[model samples]
Target chain A: MVVMSATTLGTLELAALLTVARLGNDAYGLAVRRDLTERTGRDYSVGAVYTTLQRLEDKGFVTSRASDPLPVRGGRSRRHFTLTGAGAHALREAERHTASIWGGIGTSIRPEPA
Target chain B: MLHVTPRMRDCIGAGARARVTAPRTESPPLPERVLLRLGVDPDFTDAVLGDLAEEYALRALRDGAGTARWWYSREVIRSAPHFLRSSFRYACRYERVRLAAFLGALVLTALAVLITLSARDGPPARLAGASDTVIVNSREPVQLPVQVLDAAGHVLHITGVRYQWVSGAPLHMSAAGRVACEQRGDALVRASFGALRESFLLRCRPIRRFVDWRGGLWLAVGDSAQELPIRAVGVDGTPETMLAGSAIVRDSDIASLRGLRVHPKAPGATLVDVWVGGIVDVIPITVSKRVSTSDALRPFEFFASPLRLSSGQTRRWHIPVGSYFVSFRSDTAASATAAALTLSTVGATCSRFGDAYNYFCLAAKDAALVISAPGGTSGAREFSGYLAVRRN
Candidate 1:
């Protein structure tokens, strides 16, 4: 059977995928939220970060595995997220799509891409 | 190969929520309890709550504990809806078939109970504020049919039963079981509640119809017998209990009548005459091959409620189809002598004897067993009697 590709990503989904990619081996809910907060200057809730990661994982753009729990009081196992090959390809397509959409832009208020 | 850790045995947050010594983090009791109460997936609980606590400690160090708690509460509120949805959706996807099966069973059980009660499929019912008799005098709608029992001999208390007419009558019966007078005729109706049956005579006016004797011609050859169940009905096919009895039949080489049953010795055709309350009828019988069923005798039970008889009053009962010796007796000697109670049946051999109670044993060669109490010189008129039947 022919496969249907994952749909285009929303801003939050795109940002979450990139954060998981950038974090590499260390990516999880808290790390992703901190990274997104630093880059976007918006302190997103961990719930939103986890939710987006879950959605990306659902779309096969990311995968996740639970780690051994931290040996501390009230510490629980962490769910580490990883960017998949589909995620990388989707990111490249999104960049291409955006570049194509902005290619003809020339305005006094906003300059066109170089 | 990867080594399995001790933690790996547990699927996160399952079983117990017991806390152990760990690095100080923000898993405050109230918010954690609230988040847990939101019914998040247990597999996700350890990771989700762990991440929240870790972030809580870090934030509490940078900001104050109060601010961190405020932020923690906000995060819990934000996460609750998503976790709930995901958890529910996960449960639905995984347990879809089982859930469907369970719900189907529940629905079927409820439907069965509903159907049973609506159909009134149980013991007789007592209509609220309704009499034992159903008279269709007016054009009115009813809920269900009523079963009526006669108030003679002994009163029968019944409810939630339906009227079944033995023959057609000049009476209009509604779906709700209300009876209306269609014409000036009487029909006997019977209602059976499994083993217990109650029959009543329906009267519209003066005209009384003859009770129907429901049976077919039967003849059994050599050592074979056939049960002739007599159903007494009214003029238009309703039940008539007054004329329910049988008469004697000749014990011949061809066929013999044993109570209401006929046993044939030889083949060929024969006519058997029966009488009930001065009414005589002859039915033809044809005995072919012997049937498979046996006519072996078994234990029997026969009883009647204590009968109270007035002067010159007579009552009779039909011998049920079987080989049995029936006995009738007055309750006491003084009452029997004063009442002059007599046990007699036409065409059936009977012997009278007994001083303690005016008692007599009647052979069940006949159908109708008549008991009469006549006023005597001793001046006592009314008396009670006990009737019993035993297998012969």
Candidate 2:
């Protein structure tokens, strides 16, 4: 465990864990990056995605292992990331926190000035 | 960050981040070196660069090679701040001792600054608005503050000065320079600090409210000068024997002050100012002239003329200031033998007689006298008398 103490996850860290959970066995830095950009409609940098995955791994929310040497990029091992038990709990916590913060806000029209 | 030993890394399985040798190949040399310099984790740096390279190849196939290269460069610059911060974290994880030393130095510098500021006890330039004397009224005691001034002439709250009562009875002050007085007296107060010394006169007086008669003082212009009985009131507001205050007559021509009494010199209007400290009580006196008449013995004016009254009926008179005789006689001689009349002061007897005759020497300034005529049922059916007085 990373320091054996819990670390809080930011938005990007939560999203990376969700992407890793969705990808199942195929989840890696490149696949997570592509999913985040296409789904969020914002191009997240490769560095941003890897930094979040590193943070998630440090929190013990996600664990990473090197895949067999891939044929792409003249034989480089891919760091495939997967959701741990803690990652599933972290995702549920994120959902509840989001709901609590957005619960009482109203979707009403603005009032006219006097 | 995980503090993984080389043995732990080799034996890592599930839940363990398998440390890998990030082979430096196919990644742009300059960008890879820049990522290392910016403090990105070595394995994460490899993963990030490889992902960028893979996306670049795909974008080159879909868009153009020029666009892919430009996009990659833009992405690297946009992501620099995050990479720099991540590198800082990596350095903290590795260099704990160096980081602690830096934080300790920062805290020491802050402590030094605080100590220097607290040690500064600025010297007072002078006393603020020092007056010649401070008067403490017995009613309202004088209140003076020891306000020290800064070099810029601003009044600083009293600090660091020892205020002591050097001499003066019935007056006192606390070490903090608060003054108090109980009775009419004066005190000498001195405050000193370092080489500077300041002194103030603390004078006290008694007299809170008006120190005069209820309706004011009115004394007559007598034939002989009289020592008027004036009242002196204390701070408690009772005008008894409390004579702590001094009374002054404003118009000396009309009335002159002999000790505490006001001796009238002329028939005029004047004011008497009774004061203790600055508090003053005004007494207005009207010394009107006395209406004099002939000194011959005249019949005293009764409420009724001919002095007709039923038996045992009494009458009263407020006699003026004079030496006069109180006498009464029955008009009927038949009833006079059994006739009896009693004339006396309100509380004491002045004169009384039977057999139709009453005479006595009664001298008074301002007094009320009562006289009543009496006849028994067998004596006479009517009883009457005449009362007379002569101004001497």
lDDT of 1 by residue, B52-114 (tens): 788778878899889988987888787776666545544434343444465589799999999
Number of backbone clashes in candidate 1:
23
Q: Write one digit per residue (lDDT tens) for candidate 2, span B274-331.
A: 6654566677755544443322223322122245566767776666544444456556
Of the candidates shown, which would achieve the greatest TM-score relative to the real structure? Answer: 1
Can you give the lDDT of residue B230 in candidate 2? 50
Regions of model 2 farther than 4 Å from truth: A1-7, A104-114, B1-40, B91-392
The weakest ten consecutive residues by lDDT in model 1 chain A span A69-78
Q: What is the lDDT of candidate 2?
A: 0.61
- Using DockQ as the measure, the top candidate is 1
Docking class of 1: incorrect
Question: DockQ (Cα-based) per candidate?
Answer: 0.21, 0.17
